[model samples]
Target: MSLAPRAVLVHRRTEYEELIAHHGTPGQAAFFLASRGRSVAEVEQRHRRQAEALARAAAAVPLDWRRTRVERADLPRFLFEPEDVVVVVGQDGLVANVAKYLDGQPVVGVDADPGRNPGVLVRHRADALAALLPAAARSGARHLEERTMVEAVADDTQRLLALNEVYVGQPGHQTARYRLAVDGEPAEPQASSGVLVGTGTGATGWCRSAWLERGGPLALPGAAAPALAWFVREAWPSPATGTAQVHGLLDAGRQLVLTVESDRLVAFGDGIEADALELTWGQTIRLGVAPTRLRLLG
Candidate 1:
């Protein structure tokens, strides 16, 4: 007999939970929020709604199939099987957070609060999972929309993937110093805020902001394009550093290389700062299009 497909639901911690975690008690959390002119009742309501949506999604799972629930913070430690259908329930960012860990598994992005949240990535309604789950298990390829991803390889050892963008900078967004090279070109030393490399899926985010502020000829890539865009933020000209090669495209056969000249630098993807790679001086990191793509289901 064949094994039934598994549905893995991915979610994040609620604001109320976070507050309580930090403050150690609901009363303390409420007091802290009240001091900031916020109401604990609002947090309670949001948490209640999220719990209801999660329950509904879980209830929709077919009895024949196995089911699992995971938190966003636990994704790095979670092992995903090939036959598992990944369902992310939260804001658009949650989908991005989960995409990097998946191989080619079909992802259903469920908008937990559709009325209040602008869900560009999480587009499906919570109630639609009942129908969507079976269809996805049966014909995932037909409904799949592939999105390009960015990969960073450090010293030919550690590798990190991103659904949206990779941030290479200091711990606190401080000005960083590094030597950059693109497509086998001469490396140029630079002093700036940091470097941001993103795929077409991330064009509407941080990459878009950088593109608007600094004029670049190359537009962001589309979802299915096998290309990436890179921007050097606030490249300050100094006697030791140059700002000439700051923005460009990273298509196939091309790669962006950064050598950390600072005492320490951190590289993270999909806005997960907790799980980041630490780079020291003289460490080289390469950024390019990853071989794997995110198969997002509509």
Candidate 2:
């Protein structure tokens, strides 16, 4: 007999939880927030709402099905199964945070607070999970929207994935030194803050800001476009490093290559610098469209 499908509820610690963790008690957290002209009641209210949403989500799970809960911090260490239905409850970024760790699993993005987040990835409220979860378990019962994702693979075979964008640069905010080569272009030595490779899903965020700041040279891709947009952040025009190759579009199957000349560079996705690929001098990392797409449920 086939095993029953599992429902994995993913969430991050709330501000209230973090505050209490740091301050040791509610009273202490309240005092700390009061000093900053903030209200602890607001934090407590948000915490209560989050707890209620989680409770509703938990109650929606089918009685016969197995249920698991995971926090955002533990996603890197969490093991996901193909048959598991992934439910992300929190902000839209939480969906991005978990997308890298999943392998074609159907994901349900749940917004704990409706108006708190920009309903990009997390489109549904907690009450919808009661109906969505069972349908998701039934093979091909619901529409699954596939969102494009970017991948960075190092020479050492370390690969990183991002739903929004991947940043390749120094750990600190220093200028990065590298030789950049894109498809149909000659390799050029360039000094810049870093390189950003992003998917259509991420075009509205960092990628859009970078593009607009540079006179909007390239058209940003849509959320489901099977393409990627890249930019060179603040490229320095020096005799040794040229700024000719600053930005471009990467269609499917195309790649942008960067050969590090700096002592060390790190490749991280979705702004999670804590987890990244460390690149050394002479190391080459390839950035391109990932083979895997995020199967987001609508």
Candidate 3:
């Protein structure tokens, strides 16, 4: 006899709480905001709303399942079991943050303040979770949408997955130099800001901006497509490096390989800068469709 699957509620600290944490007191935080002409009362109200939303989401979890709450900053160290169901209560970025830590778990994104910050990924309100949870747990439920994910593997060891995209660049937003190759084509040296490898879920984000700039005809992949898009940012045409292979699609059975030419390059997923992989000169990183996909509860 197995136990009921655990329900993990993921959340992040509010702006008011962060301010108080940094200033060590509410008065100091208020003063800091007042000095900058920001409204401390508004911050307090937003925090109150977030607290209420969290309470509602937690109470809505099915009584048969074990429940746990985790903060966003602590996601990397949190241990997730195979049978766990992840529920993120925040904006769309929170969903992306939790996605990297999960391995095929069903994720439900609960929008805390739908009126103020509408999100594409967070399609459900806190009040809807009562009915959403049970349906999500049932087998053969059509409420789940499988979102494509991208992966960055360094030398067959360090691997990082992203629901949105992976950024391989130099620290401090400086120029990055690397050798790029698509599929098994000959690698070419590239000098630019960095490279962005994105999935269908990320097409509307940074990838969309790049695509719009290039004015390419091909559309980005959809949610269920098993493909990836690559764009080299500001690829410089130097005497040594060429811009011919700046952007392309990585279809199935194909890969985009990048060899580090800079002294040090960092790879991070989903805009979480703190958690990253360091690649030194002569090291290679392969980017492509991840083997695992995110099962988003719609």
Candidate 4:
């Protein structure tokens, strides 16, 4: 196995306890070590208390602790072979500090406040964990092939961590124009400061705000799942000024495009850009979704 149950790849999160309280392997299971000691002495003390409590749970799970592993979590000294990991989480995001050698495990969050509503907690936790766990052991950092897209110009499949949408809003900027084309199909582009093309998975973030302001169609806001709850938060103006005539269906890979622009513009993602590729107002970018997305542990 890549990681022993209580061995390495441990990330300490705030509610790691509350989260573990719910999804933790119930039966007598050993914890490789104790408190990772990041926050303070008091915090370390809490790990001992929590470990003891976990030891006494009705499930009677084994909470055996080895020596205090100190600051790092790693593969057991004897288990040199690598195994994919199951990230242990708690109520306070990811228990980033306590768990052992979480070097390359598929980390998952348990829940922040399972007490508030146990069912809800598991629903979210499971949703996140299901996809994350497997990725840890099997993923290779490379774009195998593009199997996704949101617009016809590129792929926007449900990538784990998406680069995000583009928004050009400053109140005073005039909307840009471009002729839309899917593989060179002429679909005239409308005028807008900038058009936002987000991964279907990223429909809710700030891009949606732009959607609302632009009077775009009211899409149902769901959990970004295939059939999750979707409510029409906001949309663009009448006639869909910057609508995707053939926003090709993105699957789960990379995308590429070639655009011929006739204007000057710069776009933003999440708000800032580390790099920019100029599109002469109408040049198409072969934007493809990446295969790997990092899981932000608690």
* N/CA/C clash count, model 2: 0
The per-model lDDT (C-alpha) reads: 0.90, 0.93, 0.90, 0.35
Better of 1 and 2 by TM-score: 2
Each prediction's TM-score against the native?
0.95, 0.98, 0.97, 0.37
Q: List the candidates ranked by lDDT, beginning with the highest.
A: 2, 1, 3, 4
Give the per-residue lDDT digits (tens) of candidate 2, residues 78-126: 9999889999988899999999999988999988888888989999989
> Candidate 1: global Cα-lDDT?
0.90
- Kindly provide the TM-score of model 1 when superposed on the true structure, using C-alpha atoms: 0.95
The number of the candidate with the highest lDDT is 2
In candidate 1, which residue pairs get closer than 3 Å at backbone N, Cα or C atoms, i.e. clash? Answer: none
Which sections of candidate 3 miss by over 4 Å? none
So what's the TM-score on candidate 2?
0.98
Measured by TM-score, the strongest candidate is: 2
